[model samples]
Target: MANQREELDGSLSVDDPILSLRNASVTFDEGNSFVLNDVSLDLGRGEILGIVGESGSGKSMLAEAMLDAIPDPGVLQGEIIYRPDSDTDIDILELNKNELRSMRWEQISMVFQGAMSSFNPTMKVGAHFRETIQAHDADVKAGMSRAREALADVYLDPERVLDSYPHELSGGMQQRALIALSIVLEPDILVMDEPTAALDLLMQRSILLLLEDLKEKYDLTMVFITHDLPLVAALADRMAIMYAFDLVEAGPTDEIIDHAAHPYTRALLNSTPNLDAPLEEMRPIAGQSPAPINVPSGCSYHPRCPLADEQCRSVDPHFHDTGEAHGTACFHWQQARDDIELNYKASVSANPNTPARGDD
Candidate 1:
């Protein structure tokens, strides 16, 4: 079935996609549950692409598949082609254990969520730092001196943080350490899964600024995974909105935020608080997200979509190019484009007093 779908769409060309997922599908059991369904995406160098969706939208799962970090008993069918800094492209899913091991920290790095769980309680923060750096460059000295420098790079004091354990450091400090560790190897691309989720507002801003600085200094391409639309708006050059394991909308960040094409994207933006405006101006999207295991037929967001009609309930929609660098997967993309203002006004009207949710 996957092959047939691929044949119909024609395989995504290798030259155009730096990292592409073409007709990708992942099923937990034999036709019992499909986590991902024929999803495709293209990422390029020097670009920061943000993937925004609710908890069960498979955002993290997609990240895992991209890195080939899925455990046994999981089946992934797709082409996750990685174009390294050396100008070599390899299908991550097809790579053997040794090959995968070789690429793990050297070519790509991931800053996963839950900083506490990610670190080893038994190991000192400095030791973990040295170990990670040594894994990539064994010749490089893995001494306290180097580890201290690394700690300082992430705004941590060498003397204090280097000797401290993961549990000893504050949540923000630990997250910064993880960020520091991820870049220690200087991987070409960094996949950050909610890098600021555990941080305070001030720390989140600081971390994002640090990321911007690192990107300029190291020439790194980043994939920032988060559900926060405002954060994406502020940081991402481009953005993709995921719904039920598939991309619902994608475009330049400015265009998507200002003129969202998909209902889900608009709903997401609607849910975000507008600090500059009065509380009465804020609005939240109505209804709950569909269950991934039993995603709604046709449009996955139709159940929660205000404009959903009979057609939306029966027929699935493919991504259609609405403008240059902007696309949406909705049958009413064109109509929605015309009616965006009206829809937004109506949404705001329904929930007149809901203030925009503030950043944590």
Candidate 2:
């Protein structure tokens, strides 16, 4: 894997960001509530940027907003800038319908969540590939060749897969086919939402390996959205943690794993099961994630945060630089590392042997 953060000590961010989201917000009910709020991040070319959080954290919404694919009545606010190269800057939200049609699939393609449902059941896999390519006005004959090439790239035999319906393929095969289809157009950026969420552990690992291969083979930049932290940690060059529609923390994968600056980020890391660590060390986060419609005031994560105080209850926090290109949105980010460790030590000392409730 490439160490994009190696130069972080001297730079605040990537020298060239292929995609940028600036103060992006999405609302399904006008401005009454937001599914995504004030999200801002950058994706460097040829790098995988993983967006991870629990359900309802706006990871999918952020992905959809990037491609202007938000469903009916969902309004997107702020800028989604796509810089294909140094010479061009395209405001995604400003693009007309025709322009958008031309841009999608060719420049930015999405492998949506739920591979089983993402395809047309009645259509053969080849038909799906054919239609997608045809819609973009590419020659059907050439497109079929590209489709076959894509299938082969993902290790799927085009001969069997192209003729089969979505239901005909196994869960893992369906996912591999979906990935193949996403790349058939050879887009510069690929936005994949939970591509491996439905697969078994072994299959999931296989799919991730395939993705890593694809990333290198195609020189693809990817925005991977998922709820699994450990899974993303293995694949993403950098990780961004979102909470209640807000981006809580983002940094290089190594930096975030080694020294997470936010309480929520630490909680997530601790929550994951580690075979190398004692079972007692797996501490589940204390409370439920806040509901989107009823997001808490001030810091959205404060209600569940151990370090929250009066200020955290009344004033929202912005991203504070935590060095090495890491930025966390927490008023007590400076104190998080020690405080969380102290709390964990106290909890383990008190229980000693009892595993966390869900471990059973």
Candidate 3:
């Protein structure tokens, strides 16, 4: 396999998105269930696009769809176009097996959850790194020297990790090793699914910082998949919120965190724990997510949305842009916008002992 020669041209405006998903939908069980429903999003070059949602919200499924790793039984529809630094865009979903094989580690790479499982327990860490790099670039130097450098990039002691098996490394070390492996081929896009989920708070922060550094160093466009709103807020340039297999909101991270337009988005922001705030202040969204097989009609979120009304129960909301680079799928976005402050106030009122709204 050969790495595509399309390097970052640095010509496209920073405002121009490098990746786009248009009206994307994924279905399973012979179309009886829509795992992803008309979801669309964009990721600009060198920007981190964070995808946040609760468990069972189809966040991982969407990531798998992007990587074309959806199982055989599932069906995917819609376009995922990737533009490599202003060269012609390629439809990721349309690529055949051979094309996908070539593109996976060279053009785009994935850092799956459970980094330990991603590596072979029987193989030395160095061997795995060498194989991964060689798979994309056979001409790459296949020696201990290069492998050591790869380990060092993630702050791991090169010699110690090089000789250790996956089972021998600590959890944090394994995670960092996997991250190094993901970037070994230097793909233009790195799709990380909960890259720091398995680590402790300090380790998680460190990993995130490393990701930020690497992104700047290599100009990598990243897709950070997670349910943690605070982490997303800290690292991402933009964010897309998913619920019931559909994209409910997306926009610049700062805007999404401070001025979310979607009810679900607002709920997520409210649910996040504010360290400075009292325990009573952190109220997670109520009710379990609807099953994909039996999703609610009109809007999947209507059943759980506090702001849901007759219109929300009867009419499916379109993913409409709110004219500030923020888009939300809600029939009552305008009304919700007007009511956000009141809703937050009510939440705060319910827990008077909590810290002030802007305390953080």
lDDT per model, in order?
0.73, 0.82, 0.75
Model 3 lDDT tens row, 171-225:
8888888888877776899999998788776677677777877898767989999
Query: Which of the numbered candidates is closest to the native, going by highest TM-score?
Result: 2
TM-score for each predicted model, relative to the true structure: 0.87, 0.90, 0.87
Q: lDDT of model 2 at residue 24?
A: 80
- Pairwise TM-score winner, candidates 1 and 2: 2
lDDT of 1 by residue, 274-301 (tens): 5545566556767776664678788888
Judging by lDDT against the true structure, name the best candidate. Answer: 2
| Candidate 2 root-mean-square deviation in Å | 7.2
On TM-score, the stronger of 2 and 3 is 2
Candidate 2 residue-wise lDDT, 148-197, digit = tens: 98888877789899999999998888988999999888899999999989
**Which runs of model 3 end up more than 4 angstroms from their true locations?**
1-15, 140-146, 337-360
Cα deviation of 226, candidate 2, in Å: 0.9
Any runs in candidate 1 off by more than 4 Å, and if so which? 1-17, 85-87, 134-137, 140-148, 338-360
Which residue runs does candidate 2 get wrong by more than 4 Å?
A: 1-13, 342-360
Global lDDT of model 1? 0.73
